[model samples]
Target: MNMVNTQVRLAARPVGLPGDGDWTVTEERLPALETGQVLVRTLYVSIDPAMRGWMRGTPSYLPPLGLGDVMRAWTIGMVEDSRNTLFAEGEIVTGMLGVQRYAVTDGRGVTKIDPAEGPVSAHLGVLGVPGLSAYIGMLDIGRPREGETVVVSAAAGAVGNVAGQLARIHGCRVIGVVGGQEKCRHVVEDLGFDAAVDRRTEDVAEALRRHAPQGVDVYFDNVGGEVLDAAVRSLARGGRVVLCGAVSQYNSENGVGGLPGYISLLINRARMEGFLVFDHADRYPEARARLREWVKEGSLKVVEDVVPGRVVDFPRLLLRQFDGGNTGKLLLRVED
Candidate 1:
C-alpha cells in the first residue's frame, strides 16, 4: 500500500519542558510491510509523564529516545494491513507505536484489544499501562488492608485515580492529593475517594494528618518531591510506599529533588519501592480481567482526556501532562 505517514521526531534533547525546537514534524511515504510485520494506522497516542524522562540522554529503565527517532509513545490503533500471522487486518491493537500517524510493527509487544470490554480509548487509560501500574502498585506492592488509610498523590491522574479507587474497593479509606479545587472535588465526589488534598492550596502533610489521622498505611506516589516527603512524614507504622512515578521532578533542570522525609521511613519501619509497569507484563491478563469486571459493574469509572489532532500536534499535546492541564489519562487522538 502507498501512504504518507506524518511523524514527530526528537530534534534535540530538552533542558526542562520540551519545546517546538526539540521536535521536527515530517511526512514520509510508508514502505511496504515486510514478512511478520503489521501496518497500524494510529488512533490514540498516550501522553504520560514518563515521556519526559525518556527524552533525556541519561540512563533510565528504558533507553532515551535517540535524536531524530519517532517520539516514543504507547498507542492504540487498528491493524490496517498485516503480513504477520499473529495480527489480522481490522483488529484493534495497542503497543509502543510511537508518535506517528502510522506504525509498522512485528507484533513483539503489541496486544489485541477487545472492544466489547469497553471503549477502545479505555485500553489506553483504565485498562492500559496506567491501570496495570495502579493495580500492581496498590495490590501487589502497597498491599492495603481493610480499613487502612491509603493516600495517592496525583490522585486525579490516570494511574493515581485508579490506585485510590482500587484501595477503596479493598475497603481502605482513600485520600487523593491533587492540584486544584475542581480536581479535588472530582476525586472525592466523582471517583469515590474518601477525601482530597488540594496540593496547590492546602499543606499536604497537614492535610494528610487531618484525613488519615491514624497515619497513611499505604501511599501510592505519582508526583515525587515535596508530596513524597509529606507522605513519608505521615506514614503509619509498617507503612508501604509505592513509588509509581515522579511527575514533579520530570522537568527539573537540576536532578530529582531531595526527599527530606525519607528518614521517617526508617523510623516508622516502613518500606518504599519503585516499580515499572512493564515489569508486571506477565500478569496483564489477570489485571485486565479484574479491571474490565469493575468497569463493567460501575465499580471503577473510566476517565480520559482526549485531544483530537494530527501527528504534528503531539509535542504541544504532551505538554498538558506536565502542567496538570488534563484530568485522567491524557491522549492525543490521531485524526484520520
Candidate 2:
C-alpha cells in the first residue's frame, strides 16, 4: 500500500495579502524511501509572518518559494518510515517539512523531538523557532538590563510575546504594542507586560511616552513600519533595537518602508541590529534548554492558537497571522 501525500503549493506571487487563488493543492503517492531518506507524517505546521516574505519573487535571507513549489513551513511530524540510521520509525521530529501531509527528506535538518519536554506541537512553537528567536534576540541583541524599559511590537503574537516575557523574566519593565483592546489587555493582564499600547486606537508614540516615560532601553521589533518609528522615537540613551520580523511590511508591495525616526538612533547613541535565528544555530540547545525550563517551571507561559484542519486549509489558515485573528503562536493542526 502506498501513502498519498497532500501538499499546498505556491500558485502565484502575491501582490499584497494572499488569497485562495495564490495556492494550489495537490495530492501525490509517496515513493518508497531510499537510503538515508525518511518519510514523515506531518502533525502540526507553523504559521508565521515570514511566509509572506517567502512568497515574494526576490532575494532574501532564503530564496523565494518557486512557482508551483511546495509551500515552505516548519512542521512537527512523526516518522512513519525511515531508511536513515539516525532517525528511526515512530520517532517524532521537527524541521522545514513544507505545507504537506507527508514529507520525504534526507533527515539533514531534522531533529528528533523529546516529548517529555512538552507536547510535540510545542516543538514547532515555544520550544522551536519563536522561542529560540526570542531567547537569542532578547539576551544577545536587545540585552535588556533589570529595571530598563523594553518594548515589544506584536507583543501578543508568537515571537513578540516570548520576547516580552523574556524581558520581564530578566527584570525589565516590559510594554507591549499590540492591536485591539482585548490583545492589549491580554499582554498586561495575562502576559505580565507592565503596560500595553493598542496600535489600532492609540497613537503609538504618545502611548509609549506615557507608559515608558524614562524612554525604551530595548525594543524587540516584530511588526515594523509605524510601530518601529514610534519605538525609535522613544529610545533611551544607548538603547538597543533588535530587528526581529517586520510583519506589518511583509504584505506591502513596496516591501519594508523607510524608517523616519532612525535619526533618533544617532541622537540617543543607540544601535539597531537585525538578526536571523539561523545565524545562532550553535546556541539553539542553550536557548531551548532554558526556555523549556521556564515553561516547565511556569515562569514562561506557552500560548498556542492551534487551528485544526487538513492540508488544504493552509492558505486560509495563514491569513490569520496578518489579520490579528490569532493571539498566540498560530499553528495549523494537520488533522486527517
Candidate 3:
C-alpha cells in the first residue's frame, strides 16, 4: 500500500495578513526512503510569528520560503520508517518538518528526543526554539539585575511569556504588556508576572509608570510598534532593550512600525540590541541542557495552546497570533 502525504504549500506572497488564498493544500503519494534517510510522520507543528516575515519578499536571516514550496515549520514527529543508522522506527524526533503529514530527510538537522522527557509539543516550544530563543535572547541581551524591573510586550505569547517568567526567576520585578484582560490575567495570575498591562484597555505609558515606578531596567520587546514606543519612554537610565522580534511589523507594506522615539534613548542612556536565535546555534546545547534541568526541577513552566487539526488548517491558524486568539505557545496537532 502507498502512503499519502498531505501538505500546505505557499501559493503566493501575502499582501498584509495572509488569507486562505495564499496557500494551496495537496495530497500526494510518498516515495520510498533513500539511504541515510528517515520517513517521519508529523505529530505537532509549531505556529510562529516569523512565518509572516518568511512569506514576504524581503531581507531576512533565512531565505524566504519560495512560492510553491511546502510551508516551513518546526515540528515534532514519529519515525515511522528509517534507513538511517542514527534514527530508528518508532523514535520521536524534532526537525524542520514543514506543514506536511510526512517528511523524508537525510537526518541532517533532526534531533532524537524522548517523549517521556516532556510533552512532544514542548520540544517545539519551551524545550525547543521558543525556549532557547527566550533563554538566550533574554539572558544574553537583557541581562536583568536583581531588584530591577523588566518589561515585556506580547507577554502572553510564547517568547514573551518565557522571557518574563525567566526574568522573575532572576529576581527582577516583571511586568507584561498584553492585548486584553484575559491574557493579562494569565500572565500575572497564572504565569506569576508582577503585573500586567492590557494594551487595548489601558494607556500603555501610564501603565508602565504605575507598574514600573522606578522605571524599567530591561525590556524584552517582542512586538515592535506603539508598545515599543511606550517601553522606551519608561526606560530608566542605562536601560537595555533586547529586540527578540518585531512581530507587529511582519505584515506591514511600509516600514511603518511606529518606531520608538529616539530622544528617550539618549536622555536615558539606554541601549537596544537585536538578536536572532540562529546566530547562537553554537550554544543551543547549553541552553537546552539548562532549560531541561529547570523544567525537571519545576522552576520553569511551559504553556502550549494546541489547535487540533490537519495540515490544511495552517493558513487560518497562522492568523491567531495577530488576532490574539492563542494564549500560550500556539501549536497545531497534525496527528494523534
What is the lDDT, from 0 to 100, of the residue 276 in candidate 3? 92
For candidate 3, report its TM-score: 0.97
Q: In model 2, what are the clashing residue pairs, if there are any? A: none
Cα distance off (Å), candidate 1, residue 139: 0.5
**lDDT per model, in order?**
0.93, 0.92, 0.89
Please state every model's RMSD to the true fold in angstroms.
1.1, 1.0, 1.2
* lDDT for model 1: 0.93
| Model 1 per-residue lDDT tens digits across residues 100-207 | 999999999899988876689998898888999999999999999999999999999999999999999999999999999999999999999999999999999999
Model 1, C-alpha of 46: deviation from truth (Å): 0.6
TM-scores of the candidates are 0.98, 0.98, 0.97
| lDDT, candidate 3, 1-336, per-residue tens | 299999999999998999988999989999988889899999998999989988886668878889999999998999999999999999999998799999989999999998777777788888888888899888988999999999989999988888998898899999999999999989988889989999999999999999988899999999888999889999999999999988888888887566657678999999999999989999899988988887788767778899899888888889997788888899999854
Better of 2 and 3 by lDDT: 2
- Which regions of candidate 1 are displaced past 4 Å? none
